[model samples]
Target: MVAILGCCDSTNPVRRDGGLPGSVPAPSPGALRAEDQLPRQRRSLTSEDRSAIAVGVTCGCSYAQIGAMIGRDKSVVCREVTRNRGPDGSYWAPVAHRAAHERRRRPKPVKLAANPGLCRRIEVAMDEGWSPGLIAAMLRHEHPGTSAAARMGRVSHETIYQALYVQTRGNLRADLHRQLSLKRSARKSRGSTGRGGSHTYDHALTISQRPAQVADRAVPGHWEGDLILGRGNRSAIGTLVERSTRFVILLHLPGRRHDAPSVAQAMITEMSKLPAHLRRSITWDRGSELADYVDIQLNLQAPVYFCDPHSPWQRGSNENTNRLLRFWFEKGTDLSTHTPDDLARIAATLNARPRPTLDLKTPTQALHELLANPPAA
Candidate 1:
């Protein structure tokens, strides 16, 4: 392969009548040089290097071997070959060289710009409270064919996200951000820190005692519970999220009485309606509202576990649900103003939204599937 390296330099001033003895002929004038299109600082393949790649591909050399021959990395060879290969998988040096230069052109138009129909479809889904990822997945699902439209119709979740967040790529509707769950006008970085402590009560089980199946989400019915506090921590709504299905059930904790008995009674009343298999266990935060956990266990017939002090990630599902619930039940407001019926409606709405983790299935759909053919005892 080293013998093929003679033609790998584009700066060789010594010109041959035809070309290097055994090397592929220099790409025609139409095949632009790297310096012609890109800045000098950016490293791009030279015309000779592309010719070597063409020969290497024709000789059935691996990308790593080709890279060695051209003084580049295996990934560079792989990306060049994969990106510039012909429709029939052949690598013609001249064609590949031209394609590379074309790809280097800047300020290209966004995908949604030429596809109004795709923009409309994306907007409609967002308006229906669907995430960008779910909309992208559904697009791929609906356009599974290999035709140009089908191929062009499918955009990545990242593309949809960029269209929403990046002003340069803004082709979707201007107000579509309002349709997002968080409804932020711009992107934000997220991070978290965990706190450590043990359970305070001698009889209470900590998250460590919960069965391994609950952590793995191998079985349905394990639940994570929490409360979304309202203005001045006076009122709150109880939240329950099933681990496996991500199904949600909201408890109406009317008034400012979010104490132990009030919370436990509301939780028992809502969770008791489900089947025994669907009431396996409940993991909750260390708030005093769940002090009557024993009463909850007695009525629901499920063990109650407490998270370590200030460690909310142990109840991840419930925490996520509370965040979503905040969209409708905003902070600094009277949560008690919404009746039990309002809570039911909000829970149903949240459950109906599709989850990316659920393979785009709504929580309601996943729950119904479980009910249709539940696991045997």
Candidate 2:
């Protein structure tokens, strides 16, 4: 067959391109000259090399022959074939590439772990329930003078966070994740709210009715509030965060259905406990649960303002706090199981924790400072 095709029966034939069929094209003279000036190859495997490997293995070709065709060392070819192939010896190109990529990507040790003093600093902040962003901000606030060594020791919050969540290579202890507000086995982004739009209630004061001071966040007592629904919408927990201090208040609804009347009574019971000054106003989404806003307003004396349809960001602080609540009250679980005392404890913990928006002060401290010296309202 080879003779009929006008080619010698050499076991491996290099085409005019200087490579076997499906191999990388031959380098031009210009390419050869440029190679000397370019950086060395990372020795990483390429897709073409993997294709050659699959073909060579199918033809029972030796490692040396495959390596020559792909311009890789024989040892590299052998390792690639042995490491990436399935138990039945199949060399899928996509599988090979994924295996090689996973192997080549070796994680580096965390910077905080290398410097004991810096590690201790990070550990202390975490112990005090400081978020990674807060810790980083505090570091930036502290870094001063022209000390090169001190500056080099500081690391970003992302580095500290990767040390906690990524697979292996974390110098931090597993228990360290406890200090994080959203502790999970793996990190996941906050995604859609999954709540469908329902213009169920009418006669509402829109967020536009809200004072300009709420947007500026200069005035204390104005709070953003929302209900975080639990499993199958059968349970819920109310969240309230003051605009200025980010102080949190959680409402534990022991009842099953969080309908308007039930939620209104819960809001009244929770808000009435607050000092009259701290109960300025409550901003919430237009979910049917808050339909009894008039009742809540009459009882707590804190008028309720509804966000525009499908506009959660109007109550940004409450939305963010609800995400944090997912750390304790995981989605698709019964939230009513938690007692009011449990809710209070969680709220207190959140309140005592430092906030970057609050100038790295705990919400408790910021609220205390604001109340101690009220702004000229």
Candidate 1 lDDT over 219-294, as tens digits, reads 9999999888788778888899999899999888867789888999899889988889899999998777888889
Q: How many backbone clashes does candidate 1 have?
A: 0
User: Model 2 reaches what TM-score against the true structure?
Assistant: 0.49
Task: Assess every candidate by TM-score.
Answer: 0.55, 0.49
RMSD of each: 10.1, 14.5
Q: How accurate is candidate 1 locally (lDDT)?
A: 0.80
What would the per-residue lDDT of candidate 2 be over residues 1-377, giving only the tens digit for each residue?
01101112345464444446555664553554474535435577777768667766665667766665455667888988887778687888778998777766756445656776776777888999898898887787777543566576566788788878875544676778878875655676534444424554456788998999889987788999888888788888888899888989887777676877887888888778777778888898877788778888889887888887778888889888888778788977988899988998999988988989877899999878766765542
Residue-pair clashes per candidate: 0, 0
Q: Which ranges of candidate 2 are over 4 A from the true structure?
A: 1-200, 374-377
Lowest-sum lDDT 10-residue window in model 2? 1-10
* Best model per TM-score: 1
